[model samples]
Target: MNDIENRLKAIDFFCSGGGMSYGMLKAGIDILAGIDIDMSCKDTYEANVKNAQFIHADVFDLREDELERKMNLTKNDNNLVLIGCSPCQFWSIINTDKTKSQKSKSLLIEFSRFVKYFMPGYVVVENVPGVLRCKEESGLSSFISWLTATGYKVHFEVHNVVDYGVPQNRKRFTLIANRVTDINIIPIKQKGEVKKVKDVIGEHNGFPRIEAGHKDKSDFLHTVPRLSDINKKRLKKVSKDGGNRLEFANDPELQLNCFIGKDEAFKDTFGRLWWDKPSPTITTKFFSISNGRFTHPEEDRALSLREGATLQSFPKDYKFIGTNIAAIARMIGNAVPPEYATAIGKAIIKSQKNAI
Candidate 1:
């Protein structure tokens, strides 16, 4: 916990596409490695990150001896940090099927196994807000209990991405626990106001419109959606900047299936985002017109993969790896926005410095 440069070494667990790793690297930490179960993430994680090793293995199966060998660390290494952001599909509110039977929740306990083994100086966890609401018998609760029992000072909060300057309204539960520092982990709003959708997307942003399956020449997995005839017509009818379904649906021919009866109260469906306002949270099915308020404010199609990434605060230079729209969209949607991650990283660094 020295204030000296390069005092922290971090290992990112469940590192999908290196979003957190990238931000930590930008914040001047040495990201030693990224570990995940998905083999598909290897290329993307390695391509965009610097000097960070990518391991393709389930956290449940990970062995401390193997990780230490790979990371070139021994029992003597101090100022080490372990970061885990386990998959939260089981606890996500957006998931219609809220079954507790999901095996993925077990990964939280797996993450704790590493923490107990390494007893790193600092620990960080990020997950959906639903995680904090999960039952005490659940893995998430047990993980928190384990941290407290180990005498770590833990701070956690549900935070909105917009509060940290991301152009999207994503809420997440973030926790930072440290044995070496007493610093607060909550993020301070960098600019005092959320960034607007228009502040991030469009032709000027350098992401051009591509057909649904067409990949970007430079960044192969980044692609835009092809507008269907019906949606194209619908978008044409919408007024510029912030018009939505209600404006055109007044015409009987343009009414959506959900517009009838009590559904009329749900205006966000088929809604267009105001240009000057932050976008709604980006979801896995964000490219489909019928899902959420993804429709372009002025165009006929849902927001494209590139647009979604931009809204998530990924740099224009960040390249995604994969084929097919689902693969790419899933990667983008599941990622922690880099801008928010950067804020978390900076806080961690500050805490480490203060510990000295």
Candidate 2:
């Protein structure tokens, strides 16, 4: 345990921006340390979670004992929990191309290496739903098999973030394992009514809006991309309150070339989100209207960095440190929403408390 108050110690691998750490901490777990290859996340992760240590390194380079020592673990401490959320870019159906490198596909297997070494009491894994399909042929199936063989009961399924009180329609694969006791991640009963886009990004929040490519000098990250002349004209044509480019597909002059060849080329691009519904999955390029349904319902431009983060369920105060808007967007979009992670943490705590 990290301290007297914590019932268990957790170490997260591929811990970008400390989303998992933050949520587990909220659920009262001791998130002892976090490891990631991206140095960019170091300041943000360290800045947010004071109680945990953050390590900047690839999982392949780390040894089990070194990780254990870094986490202040002893041989006798059986309450170790490991969180592995290896990069899912290669595993994502939408992102992966045939020519894309498969280097990251090995990370799931590498995570299993640590599991075998530490033999932790509890394990949590989060990734894109495509991961489940790949893992069976890749290493994830073998990993689950190993967990069951070694006395860990495992459960995993595709879960929507909105179902867990997040204000977005993002869906992901979540897995929880417990060697200390048999457990299942209880289907989260939503705290209240479904949150809507307006609920998250309504006010404009006193931050003056800027065009695309112009930085919000006053608030470092509350900035939007500068729209191109053509896109500006297109935005004018797009209807408000959940409208998209497809509304004028017949207009040859205004229709995008990419949409010309296909029967249905992602009509959601350059789309305005619905005010009453949960926002669509906020992607790295969400600041650009050319990406999926990112335009502000009433505004003529795409969402700002702050707006994107809000849609992803990051609290207003959750400071992301990065100069480039796209880089910061990547951080927010890739993160497991803190709300979703908190529910997982709560589940772990429940199982632990009920453990024999």
Candidate 3:
């Protein structure tokens, strides 16, 4: 039994579908709430994480006093933990769209305000690594300076999630801070062995094999995107293990216009996933082969929603509560993979204990 007496409370900011909270809770933290601007995440977040209340509000709009009240944080001590994994589309290298949201860059500043108010003993943040490479030093530099001024020792690093036992090859920027002591995340080796796409979902037996765009009647979210017959034929042309759209550059009808002259325009698209390797980073449109290297190793259809969720390390029992495939996919892809969060939580608690 845990001898540490005070309630080990936590609040997750930008906690979509309670992914981070789920893992932290597993590490014995009493998660009080999850805050997000997306109202759609409310159902799934509440459904999966029972004790945590889902608050639908932009973080900037949230007053620190109100947030502290919701967390039931009375004494400011080592028992309180704050987690911030802000939305990171703007900081991502893969998304080069000119129309990306400009407002997302400042969410970290708002996170610092809450830290000042609650004076939590511990904090954890996760984001795309590009956040460290921003043009203005004012962005990340200012946040670090404030943390130091506020008396928190900070450690930030980029880590691949696969090392933390997640079955996908996603790299993220992570930061851990604590006023209680100087600390570092205990580096995690891949537990036992690196898990692959096949290990997570190859044995799942609930649904029958249906073509793309068709859902199993009993399982609504176990669905894949519909492929055109021509695209289906095109998929058949590529080898199962390491094929991509580039292979079809020689074929007139099958070739993509962007890749017709060049051998590879967007090679990851229409690419097959190797069964033994970790899956490529899951994106919001993982259901469509056109989105990423999402095609099943030996199957013609793109990854089903269930397969995508499994690759992201969401528990098999965890249920996402939306009907639209796109919205559900966004929730899964945007999440901090729970297994990775679990390692962070364990590290924080261990570090705190060592300090004592």
Cα lDDT tens digits, model 1, 40-78, are 888889988888999888777779888877887655345
Query: Can you give the TM-score per candidate against the true fold?
Result: 0.91, 0.93, 0.94
List, residue by residue over 1-356, the lDDT tens digit for candidate 3: 26557546788999998889998888777888999998999999998888888889999899988876765676466788888899988888878873665678788878878877778888888898988877253167787788888788888888999999999999988888888876555535555888987687653545346677777444436778788998998899888876888777688898877766776467888999998899999988888888789998877889888888889988877888787889989998898999988888888877766776
**Which residue pairs collide, candidate 3?**
none
Q: How close is candidate 2 to the true structure, as a TM-score?
A: 0.93
Instruction: Using lDDT, give the best candidate's number.
Output: 3
Q: Find the candidate with the highest TM-score and give its number.
A: 3
The lDDT values for all models are: 0.78, 0.81, 0.82
Off by over 4 Å in 2: 1-6, 98-101, 204-214, 218-220, 261-263
Q: In model 1, where is the ten-residue run with the lowest total lDDT?
A: 212-221
lDDT winner between 2 and 3, please give it: 3
* Pairs with backbone N, CA or C atoms under 3 Å apart (clashes), candidate 2: 212-225, 212-226, 213-225, 213-226
lDDT of 2 by residue, 110-219 (tens): 88888888888888999989889887755888888888998888988888999887889988988898887765655364778988887777654544545566666554
Candidate 3 vs. true structure, TM-score = 0.94
